[model samples]
Target: MTFDLRPWQLADFPAYQALITAPAIATAIGIDAKSTVSQQQAFENDLYQTYQAAILIDGVPQGSIVAYQRANELGEPLVNEADIAYFLSPAFWGHGIMTDVITAFIAQLPPHFTLWADVLADNIGSLRVLEKVGFTNHGTYIDLFGRQIIQFHLYR
Candidate 1:
């Protein structure tokens, strides 16, 4: 099955929440499995300033892809960099949906942009997806969850 990425809609919130909270999906995507739609929205409001899109399969909101400044805090130095985050329903894992969705998203980015992403060091699938789309590993660091994080970057 094929899918497309489109600007996110308010109506996609519920499906987005559902997708992110699925047990295996949440674990792989490195998000709290208990987050509600409201919490998700707050996150989007805070983190999706640069870009946000819903992953649609046959018109259904199956997941989301988003990018924004890695540090949105007030004191952080402004930078021409964005970090991407995405999650899909377990039902669609290994289908190369994200590989396709993100490639298209990156191509449409503004010039001089540097895209970044962080995946759990153990999530081979996500790491492979990032590498497949030309992202190079910058390094690894430990996250708050105590899981090792592999940072990936793409320069345009």
Candidate 2:
């Protein structure tokens, strides 16, 4: 299967909504599965402000990947560091699609930047993907939502 990544567009909203609201995907990303249309719209708008892209398979969006400035405990953005995140449709899971997508995404980033990712401790799939792509485990913590999270980082 041919894979590509590109900036999200207005036309992707419907697919984006569907992707994010799926129970497994929503829980993984901290999005409420029962969120209203307006709430989802707001969330989508916020994502558009970040450095994000649609993961396309044979020219159809199947998932998304994004990197945004990391924030300090006090909510200030960090220089030269970004927190990366991604999600793929359930149908695409376990096919090495995300591993390939993330590898390509990291390759295009500025060499001076450091990338971080926080995965729910129970998210074994994502943890493996990060490791396969060269991210180091920095240990774990309980997030604000009370979820056990594992932190990983890659320094270019």
Candidate 3:
């Protein structure tokens, strides 16, 4: 399967709205907002703060990937560090699409910047993907939400 990354546009909103609201995808991706409208607003804010792209397979939006300024548990932004996050539709899981997506994204990053990611310890799949893309586990810490998160970083 071919994967493409493109600048997220207003035209992609319908697909994005549908993808993030799927119960399985929402739970795994941790979008706790109750309404799609709020989620889209937050999404727009995130785009303002960082870079984001749509993950399309054969021109259909299947997921999204973003690299943005690090945010604390309470949503305070931290500069200098790029925090990467991605979510694929449940229909696309287990296909190595995310692994490929992340690898490609990493390749395009500025080598001088440090990249960071936090994964829940129980999120084995996510951890695997991070490792596969050359991220080293830094440490584990409790997040603002009170969940244990395994921190990973790639320092260039």
Query: What TM-score does prediction 1 earn?
Result: 0.86
lDDT of 3 by residue, 89-111 (tens): 88888888888999887777766
What is the model-wide C-alpha lDDT for candidate 2?
A: 0.85
Candidate 3 Cα lDDT to native: 0.81
Per-model lDDT = 0.80, 0.85, 0.81
- Go through the candidates in order and give the C-alpha RMSD of each one to the true structure: 2.4, 1.9, 2.8
lDDT of 1 by residue, 62-109 (tens): 877888765567658447688888877778888888899998888878
Candidate 1, poorest ten consecutive residues by summed lDDT = 41-50
Window of ten residues with lowest summed lDDT in model 3: 42-51
Which candidate order results from sorting by lDDT in descending order? 2, 3, 1
What's the CA error at residue 109 for candidate 2, in Å? 1.2
Top lDDT prediction, candidate number = 2
Taking all chains together, the TM-score of candidate 2 against the true structure is: 0.90
Candidate 3 versus truth, CA RMSD in Å, comes to 2.8
